[model samples]
Target chain A: MAVYTEVTDEALAEFLTHYNIGSMVAFRGIAEGVENSNYALKTTQGDFILTLYEKRVDPADLPWFLGLMEHLAAHGLSCPLPVRARDGKNLNPLAGKIAAITTFLPGVWPRRVLVEHCEPLGAALARLHLTGEGFAPKRANALGPDAWNDLLQKSAPQADSVQAGLGRELDSMLHGIVANWPRGLPSGHIHADLFPDNVFFLDGEISGLIDFYFACTDIYAYDIAICLNAWCFEKDFSFNVTKSRALLRGYMAHRALSEAETAALPVLAQGAAMRFLLTRLYDWLNTPPGAMVTPKDPLDYYRRLRFHNAAKGAAAYGL
Target chain B: MAVYTEVTDEALAEFLTHYNIGSMVAFRGIAEGVENSNYALKTTQGDFILTLYEKRVDPADLPWFLGLMEHLAAHGLSCPLPVRARDGKNLNPLAGKIAAITTFLPGVWPRRVLVEHCEPLGAALARLHLTGEGFAPKRANALGPDAWNDLLQKSAPQADSVQAGLGRELDSMLHGIVANWPRGLPSGHIHADLFPDNVFFLDGEISGLIDFYFACTDIYAYDIAICLNAWCFEKDFSFNVTKSRALLRGYMAHRALSEAETAALPVLAQGAAMRFLLTRLYDWLNTPPGAMVTPKDPLDYYRRLRFHNAAKGAAAYGL
Candidate 1:
């Protein structure tokens, strides 16, 4: 629920001159996504999404994000392709920030997670990984395990302020996970943040995958591990085994997991949980006064991490 | 930049059962308008705006607002027409709040108001008045002069806090205007808040007039007064006589103003300014802690009120 920047009508009209898209007909800021300002634009050509990258997004990484979307869309993944400007570049300058327009995908992200959503999401994840094989540009998973130490250091000072001794507990967990972190068996570009909100569904099927800001080259099985934590958790913090099995089986239907990938699931899942937990904790502690966004509770991931800790192996995740 | 209510996928799906607009293709909360939760909705039928009435808007006034849009659109005014459901009701309930879908109008609101925009706006406003002559449900101008006393009472306590002696100045102005408030100046349904943001433009022509939540029976010239304060003011708070003349001429081309209406212009404009000033002042003082909205500067209206006070007559506005 963020549109941090306002693009004036004159600015938008001038910006559109760089594109081959028809004259702008309508545009309204979209109240979704926190990292950038998004507007649903309608032109004589068609409907598209105009994204103005905010400060949180590095301008340098935009080409990678835009290129990845272009490659994936071309390879038959249902996702938005960045619209190339008249100069043959998808990334362009507008309103003092890097901005780009992408073809608008039509579908609503599922609000109520169901078993039906899990399978399609798993299949789409595999497809995206497969389709992303030949993308020329690459970005490292910035929130991966290697970066967890810095996040922990930043969040450590105020962690217990959220809950008593929460800082100590997280510190202990981080050390254990870092010490035993697995060498990934499979690695490629993965949608590091494939939360339900980023997956669109229509008529009980996954229609598109979106929000590739966090997409990066990472352990592919670790990507599955992230989903296991993200999609397989319930509102009361209970594990939904049926949904886990559905997601894993759905992924296996497309790309079978090697034995090493399967064996590494628990440790990978713990690392994934730690990744989100630390980031959320940092945001929870550092959200500026009067921010429109509600910082997600880091404790949610703490609970998920506990579940992953208790689970023995990939069998526990129905892999 | 407001979407106060969160409409879940399940609730939206259930709500659509009442409509015959085909299956929902996409829905994104629109980051526009301050008083309601608006979603840019697309379905198998076409694009539309789905609004969930927030607490700021009176639930009782929903019928009049919806009916006014229906009447004006049917009478050939380019505005959003309320879409009737399968049961033929323009107003319905969803997510425990009053909600309805209206056909989406395509155009961008003029961010930089120009003289060209003023003419079409004036003409369209006059047509809205003419076409609204027979609207069945009547809504009184809730923010008219009669309501100013209560608003002043609520805001007067903190008035001087915003500016030195501002409270005393507004108090003096309110008394004079209330004593000499114009009477019987050819009243009818008027778009009371026809701000530039509500008027959409495409290709240098007015495409539609929208945000009819404030439509009510008021002196038609008072609507012009509101526009004069809204559209004829530059960023530096100076009046633009050229735009004002264009607006008056455009309105007269459609529906001529009576001599009495013209004579009442200065006082009506002053009253219009006071109405906004008081309401804005109240909002400024009463906006809850941590509320997402940024309260508008009450002094903007106070500055306009000073302009209206200095004007000798309608001629000062190029009428």
Candidate 2:
């Protein structure tokens, strides 16, 4: 529900003139992503998405994100294609903000995680990683292992406010996870935040993958681990092994995981849980009481982290 | 930017099954209109708007509003057409709330009012009033002059907090306007809230009129007075007589105003301004500081009230 910048009709009319897409038929700010201002723009040409990169996005990373989408789309992946303007560039300026238009993808993201949804989601994710090959621009995972300690240090003082002894417990867990972080395990482009809300499904099939702002270069299996935590957990914080087994089998069918990759799932899943927990904890402690967007409960991720910590090995994940 | 009720994907799919409007191709929550939850829904048939009536709207009035829109569209006025389901009824239930689908109208509302916009807007308002003749249902204006005094009494204690002496000044002005209120000047159904945002234009012509929640049975001249304050005023609170002239002239080209209606513009305009000021003042005082939608500044309407209070006659508005 972010529309930080308002584009006046007069300004919008002038802006569309520079594009080959037919004149604007309808345009509206969409309440979808949080980091950027998005509008569902319709023209005579077709429906498209217009995004104004807000302050949270770095203007420097614009090219890489747009280029990555192009790379994936060229390889026949179902993703949003950045609409190239008559100027031969996807990015353009409008209303004093860096804005771009993308072809509208057709599907609704699943709200409830179902067992049947796991296999198809797994295959699509693996295909995404395989298709992202040969894309030269590499964006190091910003929320990777190195950043966890810094996040922990900043949040340590007030972490107990979320849960008693959460600060010290996380400090020890962070040290262990960072020390045991794997050196290499088939790395490539990964959608770090592949939550159910980011993956769109239509008629029981994966139709589209969106919100590439968080896409970056990272361990491929780490992406799988993120999905394991996001997709396999039930509302009561219990891990569903049937969904986990299906998701893993779906991934292995597309691209087989190495013996080492399979073994690292437990630790990687723990680290993945840590990344979200730290961020959510920081937000929970910092967000103003009456803020527009309610901060998610950090304890939800903490419970997942506890499960990953107690798991003996990959078998615990039904791998 | 209101989406009070979130319609889940599973629920939405089952809900759309009742309608013959083809499968959903693309849908996104739209950040427009402050009242109901609106989604820009695109299906195989065509683009449409899905509105879930929130608690702010009375469920009993749903039929009248939908029927009025139907009547308007049936008369060849460019407005949203309520799409009927197989049951031949427009109203239906979805996600524990009443929901309906309406054919989407094409056109962008003017963000900045120009002189050229007033004439077409005037004609459209007249057409809307004239076309609404046979609609049998009658609804009283909820935010009429009668509501103004109650709102003022509720907001009086803190009115001076916004500006010195604003409470007492509004009290005396309210008495004068209420006592001098016009009666029976071409009374009919009126779109009580015809601000520029409610009127859409394309290629220098009015293409659509929307947000009929405030439409009610009232003096037609009072509707004109609302337009005078909304469309004919500059940002600095100075009246734009040029725009006002074109608006009234364009309106009368369809339906001529009687002598009494013309003479009543001064007090009527002041009353209209007071109506908005009181409501905005009440909202400003009641809404917490950090609410999602910022309450519109009551001072802006206060300035408009001051101008209307000093207006001598209809000639001052270029009538």
Candidate 1 runs further than 4 Å off:
B159-161
Task: Estimate the TM-score of every prediction.
Answer: 0.94, 0.94
Expressed as tens digits, the lDDT of each residue in A268-301 for candidate 2 is 9999999999998988888774454556889999
- DockQ scores for all the models shown? 0.57, 0.50
Model 1 chain A weakest 10-residue run by lDDT:
A287-296
- Return the clash pairs for model 1, or none: none
lDDT of 1 by residue, B1-319 (tens): 7788888788888889898889889999888888899999999988999999998899888888888888888888999999888999988888889999999999999878988888898898888889999886678888998888888988888888999898888888999998988887888899999998899998888899999998899899999999999999998889999999999998999999989999989999999899989988998888764466667889999999999999999899996
Alpha-carbon RMSD of each model? 2.2, 2.3
For candidate 1, lDDT tens digit of each residue in A1-319? 7788877788999999999999999998888887889999999998999999998888888888888888889888989999999989888888788899999998998777888888888888888888888886678888888888888988888888998998889888888998988784778899998988788888888888889998899889889988988899999999998999999888988988889888888999999999988888898888764576767888999999999999898888876
Task: For each of the candidates, give the backbone clash count.
Answer: 0, 0
Please give the CA lDDT of all the candidate structures: 0.88, 0.89
The docking category that best describes candidate 1 is: medium
